[model samples]
Target: MELNRTTCYIASLRSSSVSRGYRRIIKGFTAYADVCFREFGNHVKFWTTINEANVFTIGGYNDGTSPPGRCSNCSSGNSSTETYIVGHNLLLAHASVSRLYQQKYKDKQGGSVGFSLYAFEFIPQTSSSKDDEIAIQRAKDFFYSWILGPLTFGDYPDEMKRAVGSRLPIFSKEESEQVKGSSDFIGIMHYFPALVENIKLKPSLSRNTDFYSDMGVSLTYLGNFSGFGYDVFPWAMESVLEYIKQTYGNPPVYILENGTPMKPDLELQQKDTRRIEYLQAYIGAVLKAVRNGSDTRGYFV
Candidate 1:
């Protein structure tokens, strides 16, 4: 992928049990990055593993609609384990590639390496207080901290131990150190938000409603959602920027994605005005954060 003066490209190369597959994938990716960078100079500067490692489970395994058709709860004939293994392998592979790129090009042109990943925002359901809070935290842990923990802090979240018990794999201190803080950029793609709630501690199934919605909340929590008022609030985006800044040490962030969807068929209403207002409000919030010293570079709608 050339043009726009890019020197390299990075997709998702997760780290998990599928080391062999991950290795092969990264081999191809690295070859492409090298070809593009050597041939283009300052055009492209990095490469990625795959894109959005979490989808391997969150959107694929737990949701029956996607390819591979892995069931939720992950008990779809062991498909859950398969998805987790693949996701883990991809992350490790990605880290490996970043390490290799850093080593091979250290004396060449001082170029950098990194990957782009989608990040999800989770909020606890209004009810079920303590349990809901834990649920939201768990969702965040599985959704964001899964990658961030291993990449930034060098370990999996503690909750994983409780969820999968001894089934969760362990990483050696050496391996942890190897991947810790390996990437030059942590690209974040975000849209909408998720409301989480605790359930009866059963393995998830293919068609089960999201824990949040199943707990009696509406399904708008799922994708491109913007209703139930607050359309003019920019605080949501602000909170996200602040969270990333604090958790990841303000590493250079790019708002890889941000946008709202308004159905074209709907008759115009006051909320329509609110939607435009929301955009201005949120953008202002982002600008304020940047002015106050956030590292956000750009946004994509």
Candidate 2:
């Protein structure tokens, strides 16, 4: 059987979903990607990072969804907090290999490599006043900061500094540069909108509540989680595309995933109308972004 490299998508070894208590699992698969450049120093053309690191918070951390199905490291409990650390460790592990490939094959022709990050959209509620700002920042602080800050700036988002305190790990200056330095493109896996507003911590889950669920703030409020709240706003997709373009210096972007889940209503088909519209709006944003000189190369919906 002839293998079609073009259609080949390799599982990432750096992520625990594939790494599974391993030492350098990806090393074995590089050959299959035909990543070898030269019998005599010739370089391979291109590469991409593991499937999508951004979904870890949602799947691995929050909902106990997908493989290795405990609520993830990014959650609030002692166990979940440890899981968040584990998640970061996994990210660093992946980053190490990403850097290794670039270093080992500097002379490669037309070489470009990157990874996908899932970005969840957020909208602040109107009635909450200034508390909404804190809520929005927390969400940004929780999700976007981890991937974006380090990938583009060589540091985790500063807001996380307060959250994790001394538990937060530090990178040496060299390592910091390495973390920020490795991207040739930004991979985006965006889906759905969220409404953020301050909510007082409930007594039963107060400490852990803020920890895992990341409550809006001290003020009283309510709003969206993945499926429950995405229906309210649709324009924010454009904001997300534009935000990426501006923040990441307009580096090329490949949207590796951007789909929504369907409601389980009887009338609905697996065709998932909400998911389809979600995709359409986001794709429209991508087009508008490209036309506006945003260097958005392509997207996979």
TM-score per candidate, chains pooled: 0.73, 0.70
Q: Candidate 1: global Cα-lDDT?
A: 0.59
Please report, in order, the local distance difference test score of every candidate based on alpha carbons.
0.59, 0.57
Best candidate, TM-score: 1
**Candidate 2 C-alpha lDDT tens digits along 1-301:** 3211121233322334332223243444444334433332243334555556656544644454544444433332233353455445545654665666666665554466676666666667764577776777777766676677777888887777666666556767876877775677777766666667767665685555323354344322222444643442335556677777787677777776665544577655745666666667777777877787778777775
Candidates' RMSD to native? 5.7, 6.2
Tens digits of per-residue lDDT for model 1, 79-195:
335445555555666677677667766467565665566665567766658877766667666667767778888787777645544445566788788768876766666665666
Count steric clashes of candidate 1. 37
User: How many residue pairs of model 2 clash at the backbone?
Assistant: 7
Over all chains combined, what TM-score does candidate 1 have? 0.73
